[model samples]
Target: MTATTLDAVTPAGAAARRPVSGTVHSWDLSTGVDGPGSRFVTFLSGCPLQCLYCQNPDTLRMRNGRRVAADEIVAEAAKYRRFIRAAGGGATISGGEPLLQPVFAGELFHRFKHELGYHTALDTSGYLGARATDALLRDVDLVLLDIKSWDRDTYRKVTGRSLEPTLDFARRLADLGKEVWVRFVLVPGLTDDPANIERVAAFAASLGNVSRVDVLPFHKLGEAKWAALGMDFALRDTPSPTPREVAEAREIFASQGLTAV
Candidate 1:
């Protein structure tokens, strides 16, 4: 099991340490929070969407995480630069939704880029507004944007939000020449529909600067977290996506001239 720790400090101490202001719900200062390649990742607090498959349900509540300053986060991230450089990886600011805390993320990204010179990435669901998108994109080097589904109805059913904003955000990123890796969770009988996959592939092909497409096979890793939070697990009986299903989705994207990772 993956273990997590929480650190709480006084506002004054936090302020004196970092120039940026905001609350950090939780943070993982370890290597490989997302995958291989040693890197530091900060799990920012708060989110606007209620994705049914989200594993970090505790981060959904805005008030539940500890309050932390931006500089403090930067300071913590700086310590891992050597590891990040050696592994060809850097710091990634993830969330409940990083865009929800634009100011904090912006400040952190600016410091990492200009001050520390560490590569930066944003792992988001891409549901932020135009203004927020512009601010967050200024310093982000790589974007791991999640596109839940191409159909508005399916997106609404899965994430409890509209699909237009996310699509618009993706387009905006492409226009800015930002490197984006579009990700989709391949959920059986939900997002794995061949028709939907074709539509999504077509849409992604329309965007420029999308270097990669990732087809993530859905798993029930977060079900226990949901149960612990006393929240209903919608995909309780949903089996993990099969290898054949994943291969099919990959093939769909490959045929669209996009490299599927």
Candidate 2:
């Protein structure tokens, strides 16, 4: 739904013209889950993966979003700037894969971190991590990286994408010494394999830059959204992981000498 307009004269014809625009699903304020504290989270639209457990199925496509300029998003966040700062939270660019609109995401980070002096985070699957420029990473204070599954085929079954790209991106983030919080969903039948959990734990531990690991238990909260979108909810019968399973998965990460919660 978002389109960039180029001048007929030249690419840099207008200084007043917005430098970047993107498809935005929505924005909200959240605490505890998104980042360090309270966060002004902007959910950009468009994702390459078709993760069966994706909660925001409505954000799967670009056309389903509203076209907005980066300035508009930042200005909205400015209204909550004082409150966010007081809570020890900041701005986070989340998505249907934030890297899908790298330029727009980068601009948001620049404005939020440099201009507003707030902590910035990117919540991404890292499927398109290659799209992130060095400058963009420089502005990001934390990365909420989703490592869906560790087994290659299981990853594909869960997300319909290759697992290597996410791993490659994690390594890249490690090399940059960027702060990261690795997020993994515990699906009772699909992703709870002990070996898979161990692989994910080991990989995250090897990163050396990972600060925390969040073992999120999967639920059916998004089934209605999928039903509304007329899409198949493949994991409808899948149950949430039991407390013991969740605790055990967390223990796997702890065994790797990584903090898991």
Model 2 Cα displacement at 1 (Å)? 2.6
TM-score on alpha carbons, each prediction: 0.89, 0.94
Candidate 2, 34-59: lDDT as tens digits:
99999999998889999999999998
Residue 143 CA error for candidate 2 (Å)? 0.7
Q: Give the TM-score comparing model 1 with the true structure, all chains together.
A: 0.89
Rate residue 90 of model 1 by lDDT.
75
The whole-model lDDT of each prediction reads 0.79, 0.89
Show how many residue pairs clash in every candidate, following the order shown.
3, 0
Best by TM-score: 2
lDDT (10s digit) by residue, model 1, range 1-261:
011112222222255653556656677755643533666788877777898788788888766677677778878888877877888777788878887767667777777778888778888988874545465577788888899999889999999999998898888888889888888899987888899999999999899787889899899988888989889999998998879889989999999999997
Candidate achieving the largest lDDT? 2
